[model samples]
Target: MTYTAPITEQTFVLETVAGIGEIQQLPAYESATPDLVQAILVEAGKLASGVFAPLNRKGDTEGAKWNDGAVTLPAGFADAYRQYVEGGWGSLGADPVYGGQGMPFVLASAVQEQLTSANMAFSLCMMLTQGAIEALGAHASEDQKQEYLTKLISGEWTGTMNLTEPQAGSDVGALRSRAEPHADGSYRITGQKIFITWGEHDVADNIIHLVLARLPDAPGGTKGISLFIVPKILPDGSRNDLRCVSIEHKLGIHASPTCTMSYGDEGNCIGYLVGAENAGMRAMFTMMNHARINVGMQGVSVAERAYQHALAFSKERVQVKRIIEHPDVRRMLMTMKSTTEAIRALGYLNAAAVDRAHGESDTEAKREWQALADLLTPVTKGYATDMGVEMSSLAVQVFGGMGFIEETGAAQHLRDSRIAPIYEGTNGIQALDLVNRKLPQGRWKPLFADIRETIRALPGDGDLGAIKPYLDDGLAALENATVWLVGNHGDGFDDAAAGATPYLRMFGIVAGGWLLAKQALAASERLAAGEGDPAFLKAKIVTARFFAEQIVPQGTALLGPITRGGALLFALDEAQFAA
Candidate 1:
């Protein structure tokens, strides 16, 4: 099945539900007019479907090749990258002052979804560079920006984040990378970084590495860690004393190199400090947060691809009749469709929150939006990724025995999606962040209140019928869970932590339902007015109804685990696992 960019669907979400109109009204995003937005979406969709989608299967088959200390991407990867750069797709959401188009990230999110769906392995390189651009623009010195930003934004060069070491997976403080200061305002970075995505490749002129290392006099742990710009080529046109010693053989996304990098083996590798010493964790997080959301988009991206593939397969595959005629197959397809749309909606909503947080003039409004963004980030990352895995698995189930074979391409999606939940912070960590970091901010009252009011404002049975009650009940369950988590945080934290994963899932269920309900409402109003495509609008209504009926109920069940699951979780002894 050909990968078609869901431009119409994405546009509906953007304009109807994600508040792109309000985003346009904001002076910061004045360039994002309706026409411009449409053009960008259309062009991006073309690039995704025409160019990137074609390489996906081949990339998976050929993968990236490692020869000596260098890595070569799959055939056509370099040319496609050249096209991506020439088209200025890399600079879409970057800062304009440094040669970026300065598009809103919401639009970027949509484009990224298309790209990832079309060709996940190929697009990983671009996504990492985008994260690097964000980090550098936000934290790098003016001189550093002048040196690196334009090239990075223009895609003449690429970038990587090197925080993970052999000893340090999620524990940044445990990293053993070192940075020794030099007299000429630079540092000699010596470290072994592992699992560095797009860490080494032939596509770009230079690869700028944002590495985390401890200075000699640095105190300890994460507080002593510092971020440095370690480029493959020095500014003076010399090779840095760094090499990609090896690239990992991964389960999926084989076209993208995941390298084990060694720095300063020959001598001291020159590196430029990014921010204040010991603030490496802070600065890296700037990139990580950016990467996390993009990872969520990755989940949405792969899900979309898998869903399309499965939908096509079902219609053509006959089992007594077309599999599409099978009720179970229809249910599976509905689940995949509704879940993908829900995740897409949540991703866009997060992007819009990001725009509001960035563009709003009022401090309080900005803070509120920022809080909302922060809250949703974990849910989006964790829930969407978890769903991506499930959706892909369902896609395989739809294909039955054929899905187990590589030739059908269903398994590739499953493989590609598995890494998302593991990297950019595990989904477990995301859940912890949701419960311990995000919810602790005390921002839930207003958000929860808004969810309730939105539910209340929904039209009655005439318009929504059974959908209204399902959504209402979901909100009620979510509200109860929120109250339980918040009220019990003081005395019930242990249980809360144990239940964090399900709580996050519940939150996603409600949030996705709420957003889908908003879309359904929009479609309902448009249908009543007799102004839009009746088929599309009718489908939207049906999808939303299915989500409310089938998915929303899961939120209610999570409340028990959220309030009472911790003791049982901890009941098992550390040694009991061996039994």
Candidate 2:
């Protein structure tokens, strides 16, 4: 119930570890000067703390209601959404030519973390809309853009991504959704799509759904899928045949409607193609790649929210003279805080990489920036979401009996965080992507070089005197793992696959340590110069030390699992598990 945007910490990460200043130098982001960015963060913080934070508990309690194929969001949600639009928050990172502020994605990401921390369920609509904007901007035809982009950007309408069905969850190639060509050049769509977030809601006049279905003569796999723009309101202002057949009673994100949409129930539902035929997966993935980072931010958000909740609770709920004074509770709080900050920096770093990729004009620089961004994406999503769950659970522990109850709201954060790792390509899939897709993308060497350089840049004999060795060990472990994985990639494919999850976790741990160390070095420099806020700077050093000591060591321990083949995991027969 208590939350304040960590604007100062976020700003620190952006300017320091994430290279925001360099990003600002880019021509495309010249408009986002330091003062303007600070002002935006200040205003965004006010809205997040004032408008959205108050509604979070209420939304979770009241939730979105489904009746007669329509969803009614809890009271004040529509008003908050309107304010969100009027304030131009929704269009910050969208293209300027299309009714947006055209801010850099890194800056937008900072604001997004604040929103998600304040009210995650409410933020989901905005996140999905951002994805829709990206997909439409990238692939939608000019006519489609003219018809939909501005309205969606302005928040007069919203969007949904429909990819899942009863039979097809992760296996998109198995989908049975069919799209038949119409005389008017549109396609008649018929299928049931489930777990569509913000799929059906009344906050906006229309919902533009980016759907995936197959043509009758298309191939029999993911290769044949085609993307469609199916709207709730037809171009003629008539109602489309698509309807929300039902809304899932979910474990969390209670206020965000997850609909099971039935398209063309009467065989009159029309859809416009987004990209070329048999290219639906590519288009959908464009939106998905955008969503994955935001989803990772969601993890950071909930963890942040939970940490604040626990810190407040620990300070107030006195046991043996303030629970935070207890060693074990202190340890838990430090773990939560340090991990959250580390991942926050990682997320910002990822965002900054993405920004550089977009804004950089040089061909080679752009490719390198994009590679860094791609490399961090899976780690950011997988590790941060996993940390979110861990931090949220730690919050419950801090609250003791109170956290278990819904009234305390700690449990809600855990429940909400649980879905993040499962969705946006489950963490397991993220690991596989890290090893199979990202590692082979040929960025690991440069990425590892960057990591080592960061560690090497730290003051070896200064205020962080004792922590340097652990960070070194962590970096060494990561390098060894990377070498093993890459060396054995072809011949030891099964071993690499089995160790993929831990390997990614180790990647995050080392990356996080490097950033935290960078932050610590900055803090120490400020302290030595007798500049900036001494108390905050000192705390940064301590947090970094805590991470170095407590967290970095885990990276080395994962080597055992990394080299172990999947034989043990797969040795038993499917039916033998019950025995």
Error of 1 at 36 (Å): 1.0
Q: At residue 476, give the lDDT of candidate 1.
A: 79
Which residue pairs in candidate 1 have backbone atoms (N, alpha carbon, C) closer than 3 angstroms, thus clashing? Answer: none
> What tens digits encode model 1's per-residue C-alpha lDDT throughout 1-579?
489998889999998767999999998899999999999999999999999999999989999998999899877888988999999999998889999987899999999899999999888899999999989998999999989989999999999999899899999899999998889989888879999999999998999999999999998888898999999999999999999999989999999899999999977799999989889888999899989999999999999999999999999999899999999999999999999999999999898999999999999999999998999999999999999999999999999999999999999999999999999999999998988888879777787787777677677775466677877887777778777777667777787788888899999999888888888889988998997789999999889889989999988777787777577876889999889
Q: lDDT (CA) for every model shown?
A: 0.90, 0.91
Candidate 1 versus truth, CA RMSD in Å, comes to 1.1
Q: Residue-wise lDDT of candidate 2 within 398-465, one digit each (tens)?
A: 99999999988989999888889998789999999999888877897887787777767776575577
The C-alpha local distance difference test score for the whole of candidate 2 amounts to 0.91
Candidate 2 collision pairs: none
